[model samples]
Each structure stands twice: as C-alpha cells, then as structure tokens.
Target: MARALNDGPGRECPPALPFVLAVGVTGHRKDALPADSLLTLHDRLATVLKALTEQAAAVQEANQSFFSDAPPRLLFVSPLADGADQIAAEIALRLGFELHAVLPFDRGRYRADMSDEDGRVRFDALLSRATCVLELSGESDHHLESYVMAGRATVAHCDLLIAVWDGLPPRGRGGTGEVVRLAHDRATPTIHVPVAASDELKIRWSAFDPAVVTHAEDQANVRTFGEEELGAVLTAVLSPPPDEREREFIHMFQGECRRKLRTRIEYPLLLAATGVARLRRHHWRPEIGAVRTHEEWQTYCDACHKVAAVTTPIASLQSWYEWADTLASDYAQSYRSGHVFNFVLAAFAVLLALTTLVLPDAKKILAVAEFAAILAILLNTQIGVRRQWHRRWLDYRQLAERLRPMRSLKLLGLAAPDPPGTAANPTFGRWVDWYAAVVWRGMGCPSGAIDGDRLKAMASTIAEHELAPQVAYNKSVANQAERLDHRLEIVGLTLFTTALLGCVVLLLGFAFAPHWVKANSNWFTLLSAGLPAIGTAIFGIRVQGDYVGSAVRSEQTARVLEQIADRLTRNSSNLSRAGDLVEEAARAMHADLDEWRLLNQQHDLSVG
Candidate 1:
C-alpha cells in the first residue's frame, strides 16, 4: 500500500541538420592578379559553382521526402573587396548561388579603399545584388580592426574558404596572408590559387624582425588543381559527414526536467504569499487600470511575466523536455506520498479498533485514538484531491511522452504531420501543436537530395541511435508495470484470506462451546470486526493505484514500438520505408497518449 516511487520515462529531441553551406573568399587586391588571369580565375570559379548547383540538384532528387517547404540553399559569402571577393561573388551570382557580404564598415567609408573609379562602380553594383550585407557597427573605417572583423565574420559563418595569393607575408594588417593563416588555424578547408610574381620594388617591414626583411626572390608560383580535384573537394565540403550523429533526447530530458518542476511547485507558494500580504492590508484596491505605487506596479509586472514564462513555448527541444519532465515527476512524487500516508493511517486505525475491543481497561481512550487516525487518513485524501496532484501528473506525463518521438523524427528528417494533411501551427498554446510547430520550423525543408550512400547512413543511424534505445525502454516499462500489478493483486487477496479465517474462528467458538465462548467473547468480536476492516482498506488501496489497467496499457505500447523497431532494423528496408516506419511509430506514440488521457479522466478522484 506504500506510494510507488518508480521513475517515469524521459523525453528527447532530434538533432537538426545544417540548412546551408557558406563558402568564404579571401585573396589579394586587384593589382596582384593581372586582368587576364583575373578573368581566367572568374571563369574557372564559375564552372566550379555550376557543378556544385548540379550536385545539390542530385541530392534533392534522391531524398525528396526529407525536405521541408523551403529548400536549403548554397550560400557564397565574401567581404566583397576589390579583387578575389568581387570575382567570386560575380561568378556565384551567375550560377544562382546566394551572395552575402560581410563588410568591414559602412559603404561610404569602405568605398575609399577601392582607389580606382571603375573599381568603386563595380563594388556598388555587387553590393546591390547581395542577398544580405552584414556591416560591422561601432567601428571606425579608418582602423585596420574593422577589416579584420569582417574577415573573422566571413570565416565564422562559412564551411569552406577560397584564397588567391602569391605566398607572400602580409604587408599590413587585414591583408590576404593574415586571413589565410587564420583560416588554416581554424582547420577550415581552403583552395589556394597561386598568383604571378611581381618585379616591382617592395617595401618590407616586420615589427618582429630587427631590420626590414626582404625576399631574395618572389615565392609566387603556379600549381593549379585539375577540374576533378576541385570537384572532389567541393563535394566533400558540401556533403554532410556520414558519421556525424545527433544527441539523444532522453539524456537532455533527465537534466532539464528537475529545474522545470521546481519552478512549477514554487509558483503557487509565491502567489499565495503575495495574495495574503495584500489581504492583511484593509481596503487595498490593486485595480489593473488604477494608479499604483512603484511596489504594486512591480508586483503586477512580475506576476504577468511569470505567467508568460510558463505558458510560452520553450524554443529549445532540450529545454521543453526538461520542463515537462520536471512538472510530471514532482507532481507524481506528491501524489504517491499522499497515498502512502493515507494507506498506513487507514490500516493502523483498524488495528487500534481491535486493540480497544479486547483490552480490559481504557477502552474509550483507545476508541478515540482509532477515530483520530481515521480522521487523519480522510484529511490527507481530501488535501491530495484539492491540490489535483494526480491529475496534473498524468497530464504532464502525457505531454512529455508525446514530445519524445518528435525529437527523433525531426532529427532523422522523417516527421509526418499529425493526422496527416493537418497544418500544425507550432505557436498554438496546446503543447502538442506547439512542439510540432517548433520542430518543423527548427528542421526546415531541405532541398538537396540525399544520395543513396548518405541515405543508407541515415537508416543505420535511426536503427542504432533511436529505435534501439526506445525499444529497450518501452519493454522495461511494460515489465515493471506488470510486476507491480501482480504484487497489488497478491497483497489484496492475502488480506481477504486473513479476514475470512478470522470469521471462521469466531463462528466456531460461538457454535461449539457456549461456556468457553462467554469467557472469550471480546476476542471473537475484535477478530470479526478488525480483520474485515483491514481487508477493506487493502482493497481500497488497490483500486486507487489502478495497477492492472496501467500494466495492460504499457504492454500494448511496448508491443507497438517493438514491431516498429523490427521494421526499422530489417536489412532490406530502404530509406523511404524507414521513413514510413518512423511515421507509424509517431502515430502509435500519440495513440498511447490519447489512451492515457482517457484513462486518467475516467478515473478522476474527488474528496466527496
């Protein structure tokens, strides 16, 4: 009859895919690359970009089902400086790739670096065509730090870097060589195009060196990669790594749920304290539209903010899972503790009654104590019902489980619409809709088709990472529920057997030896009443726990998930079929939630 302290299942969210591949550009000024060579670099860069577009199209074709409403795009980002950046941007634009400019400073001052009138005109035209321009604010254009900031921003967002250089050290800060070194240190992949050696006199000054250091001969030399090598590098950079795996949702659930639950429990206590303080002050009218003191206004604002915090959708999947899990676990613990105390009190009361009947003296005192015990039991039950701890526990648990599958589905790029064809607006306050919307927005439609090799890798990931763990967890839950169910029935029946035996003994003593019966009549009476009373309390505890019903429901859910796991693990299952199986599992999970909700509603308990 002790309250169950079993831990419930935790939830997890699926990891998201990278939405775009950003390519960054860094190289020398226009003077370093002759006009003829600059045109050659432009044509070669354009050809490479066109081939990349085709590769994206091929990926899109293979993984048609994985995409969201808006397909992912290939983004080419640059500082749009006078030489290499401008050439790359012009080529990328022609190939239908997005061009994002990360400027060192505002255009007016940055334009001063162009020097030539023709270069300034081209810079303005390219800036107009850019999809996005990120200007470094609060920095003077006159400073070299501004240019460095732009270079750092470009590297930060891009997956690959293209450098056009003459293998020379930087003449000043924010030069091509310095940017290339940064890219190398960060392990960003780069394709360097060599420039022709210049015969002009060079002014070399190194702050680190004692005297001005000059190169005996220019290091600039040609060693260009073939078309095949460039294509292979581009493919490697753009494609998602086959081995990269997303983190599981349950791990996050376990961590986050505790914090969320604590906040929930504190809210009511805080609100109650606030209410009583105002009540103590006679005729304190804290009307919404009325003028108030600073303290009153602050309290009002704080209350509103707390309400918003609870009701709003938690943006991160990990955060959302934690809150729901914490709410469920805390409420469940409270519900269990109340039932345990009530069960113990009820049984003790019955024992006290039997003692009062058989005792030679202080019978009235013993009876009063027994009555007090019963009153305590009833009071505890009333308090539990008024607080609605059991109901809230069930509701929060339902929400948590429903969200778990969504994390996996979204991560695998196989999530289906709830009740297919229904548009789920995630902003909806209802947890289900809100969670669905958040996941959908988080994992937007990917336009690139996944090749067969990538598709196979995804299938293996689903089987090992998601389906395998879920299968094990559900099976364990089912087994635990069944064991609890069996124990409850056994205990309930044993109590009834004890009561029946006590009745048999009482009847036999009264029927066969009349003289002996009179001498021990009090004992017989005690046995007849107290044993049955204890048995009745045992039955009541069993009814409250609903162990049998829970066991059956858990077993059904476990079986459903197990079947889905089988489908997912089959060697012949293609990516499309795996997607279908995942979708089926999601449906099954939701169905389980609906069933639990109905059961909790039907068995709603009240003090009356």
Candidate 2:
C-alpha cells in the first residue's frame, strides 16, 4: 500500500471530483420602488441569469476536466425581502436555481418587520420556497447593524451580485447601494439593473473601482455588459488557467501508481531515527492522532452536519483534500528520497574509486563500479528534474494545506486563506487558488440561524477537531525534525572526527615507524578520503532536508495554534471572536506552509 506522509493511522486514499455558482440580490424594497420599473427590472435580471446559466454550460463544456459530469449548480442567495429580493428568488426558482435565503433576523421577526400584510404573506411564501435559510442573530435595538451584516454575508457567499438599484446613494445603512459597495470591495462581479424611471434599464457590469465616486452618475457611466462580456467574466472565474504543466500534474497525481522503491527504502531509516528520539522523550503526549483518517474526517463532517440546517457537500471537500494530500505525500517521499539516494551514490562512487588504491588487482572492477555509480547519479537527478518531483510536492502540499482549513472556514462563511504575497509573486500557482476557491464556492454556506448556542457549538468543534489536531501535528513534526537533525549532525561529526584522528595517526606513524606507515598507507588514504567524502555527503543531505529549520518553524506554529485554541475556548460564545480566532489560526498555518515551501524550493536535486 502507498503510504501518506504524516498521515494518521487508518487513513485511506480516495479517488478524485465541480463547483456551484452563487448569485446574490440587493435592491430597493417594494415601498420605495416605482411601479413601472419593477417589470423592466425583473426582465433584465432574468436575462442576466439566463445568460449566466448558458455561459456556465459553455465554460463547463470547454473545461470538462475541471468538473464532473453534473453541470455547475446555480445557487440564488437572497434575504427574501418584500420587493427585489422576492422578485429575484421567484425568477431564480423559475430558472431552476436553488434559493438560499440569508436574513438579517429570524423568520418571525423578519416577517413582522414587513409593513403590509400582503408583503408579509409574500415573504413567508418565498421563505418556504427557499432551499435553505440562514438567519442571523441580532438584538432589536441593533437591527440596522444586523442588516449590514446580512448584506455583507450575502456578498461574501455569492459569486455574482445583482443589484436592482435606482442609481442613487444608499439611503439607509444596509440597502441596495451598501450591498453593491460591499460586493465591489470584495471584487465579486456585479450586474447593475437600473430601477430608476429616468435611467434606462441597460444592464452593465459594475467593475470595482476604489477611486470611483459612490454616486449614481459614476455607476451608470460603466460599460454595458453584453453577451460576450458576460461570457468572458464567467469563463475567467470558472476555468483554470491554460497551464499545461498543472494539467499534467493533475493527471499524474490521479493516475494509479505504486510507491517508488527508493522512498520505501528510505522510510525505515527515518522511522527508526524518529522513533528512537520519541521514545527518549517523556513529557508530551499527542493531543490528537498524527495522521488524519477517513473516520476522523467523518466525525468532523458529522459535527458540521449536526449544526447545519441544509445539507453541505463537506464530504466532497474532504475527498479533494484527501486526494491532494495523498499525492503530496507521494511526491514528498520521492523528492526527498531522490536527494538522499544521490548523496549516497556520490559517496559510494568516491569510496569505490578509492578502493582501487587498496586492491590494485581489482582496479578494473572498481573503475567499472564507480562509472556505474556516476551514471546512476546522473540518471536520478535527470529523472527528478524532468518529472518535477520537488515542484509537484510543493504545489500539492500548498493546495492540500489550503483546503484543510476550509472545513472550519466554510462553516464560518470565510473563504480559503491565500498565501501571503500571492499577488506580488507571479510564480505562485494561481491555479491552486482558483481550484480552492471553486471548491469553496461549490460548498456554499450552511443554511441556518447561527444563534449563541450554535456559535458556541461550532467553536468547540473547531477547537477540538481543527485546532487541537493541528497543534499536535505541528508539535510532533517539530520533535521528529529536531531529533533527525541532531542524529545527522552527530553522525557527520563522528565521521569527520574519526577522519581527523586517522590523519594524526598517519602523521605519527610516518615519523616513528616508516615501514609500518608504508604498509598501511592505503588504509590511511581510505580513512582520510572516504570518511570525509561520506561525511560531506551526510552534511549535504542534512542541509537539503533542512530538518533544523523545519523543527523551529513547526514549533513556532504549534505555539501560535495553542494560543488560538486557548482564545477560542474562552470566547466560544462570541461569533465574531471565534471567526477571528479561526482566521488567525489559518494565517499561522499559511505562514508555516509558505516558509516550508521557501526552504525546500531552492534545494532541488543536484549532483553536488
């Protein structure tokens, strides 16, 4: 069976999986709406939805590798308010889009806030039709802030925002204009449907511009969103970039392959060294299992399901993470083994060549063996470089780590955290970001009211499952790395010290016993040459692995996670506080991963 790196016992490798496109709505309520404008607004909104649906199909067809057989799911996110919200929900339902309602208050309070009986009835009808409802908790006195939170939540959850506005500034705290601004700030695509009688109903894309004035004239001046423009936007958001290397990597990762023999051979040495070190230590017990198993993942999903109102595709996210994690482990083993074997081969080649001096009768055989060793080194390095084992290991590990936190982030309505400086570093794998974002969009938000009780439950679950396990894993990694570094350092030092003693012995023998020195000179030469060559090789492996650096980074990360876990335990009931802790934990993990990538990227396989 193929082994996973740092995987917990009983972990199973799974096979590979598409995404959901969420469209949100923000517009004026019925009381403020012009009667004549409603019909045109409805028509334009429907047209945009239809265009999106059609364009999604085209993009899926073009990029079938990225998606499954099922077409992309279209989710309509709305608060189901009296006017524009209800209108968009109705149109979305008619177009077969799944409605996910995000309300500022619970259903009862939201219904009672409607001014008229007819509006209340419409609201209930739409609410009943919604596939899932996310009710936000808010006190009566702070209803305006709640509305702002709801609007921001809707914008955060959706891929596209449809603002049915009158091309004017927001009159209230959380109205159509405010939602549009939130969407703009988030860089979510928005389609503006003019509801003002004076402004024509020409649908256009509202590109986010930080410098643009928040006025009707400036908003209306943007270019019209025609069919081609909409298609371009959909394609850009939905499809991964046309990078052939990434595509090839996906194929290789998903294909069935056995573990490399070199990696298998190296594992026992690593295991023995770490196992001895762990046996020597006594104070720390693992907080959680070292490896994450399928059963553990199921437990996590069960916790999420218990609190969630609607069914979330969390298992799908797990499968993606598992697939990436498995591949990353495989590549890590291969890449690390490649360097180890190269170092060993280089030292062996030196030893073999030096043996010719000791046994001159076998010079031809030693020369042939040394030549083969050199050839093997060239072959190994070439294969590693050509196959990109190091590159794939870094990329897949980065992707897996990003996906790992989504289990908690999705529940909190937070997107996957990006590596720092991703925008500035053009070499960063943008396709990884696109892939993670697609998974996040596909999972969407769990529909339900997050009361204080639910907030506390989710926080506890995160602490127990997410943060605790990571803390344990990081500590274990740090210990293991420190132990390996220490062992290698000792071994390298012993070899060099013995070589130095051999030199002193050879010097003393030449002065005191010339005949004895002449008889045993080959032994001294082997000691002086072979020991140092092997010692240098060992040193090279140590540097290439960067075990000491890894230990320090992992230890620091463990401390940060412990701090976050403590804060989460204390502020479990506060939703904002819990969300902040989760983000902080995620940032810490991302920082660690970034450091690991930087440390390993420059240590690619080389003959030296």
**What would the TM-scores of all predictions be?**
0.47, 0.86
Report the poorest 10 consecutive residues by lDDT, candidate 1. 201-210
Q: Estimate, for each residue in 144-183, the C-alpha lDDT of model 1 and write its tens digit.
A: 6556656655654565567777667677777777776655
> Model 2: clashing residue pairs?
7-291, 8-291
Candidate 2, residues 159-206: lDDT per residue as tens digits? Answer: 778888876777788788888776654556678788874564433333
Best-matching candidate per TM-score: 2
- lDDT assessment of candidate 2: 0.74
lDDT: which candidate is best?
2
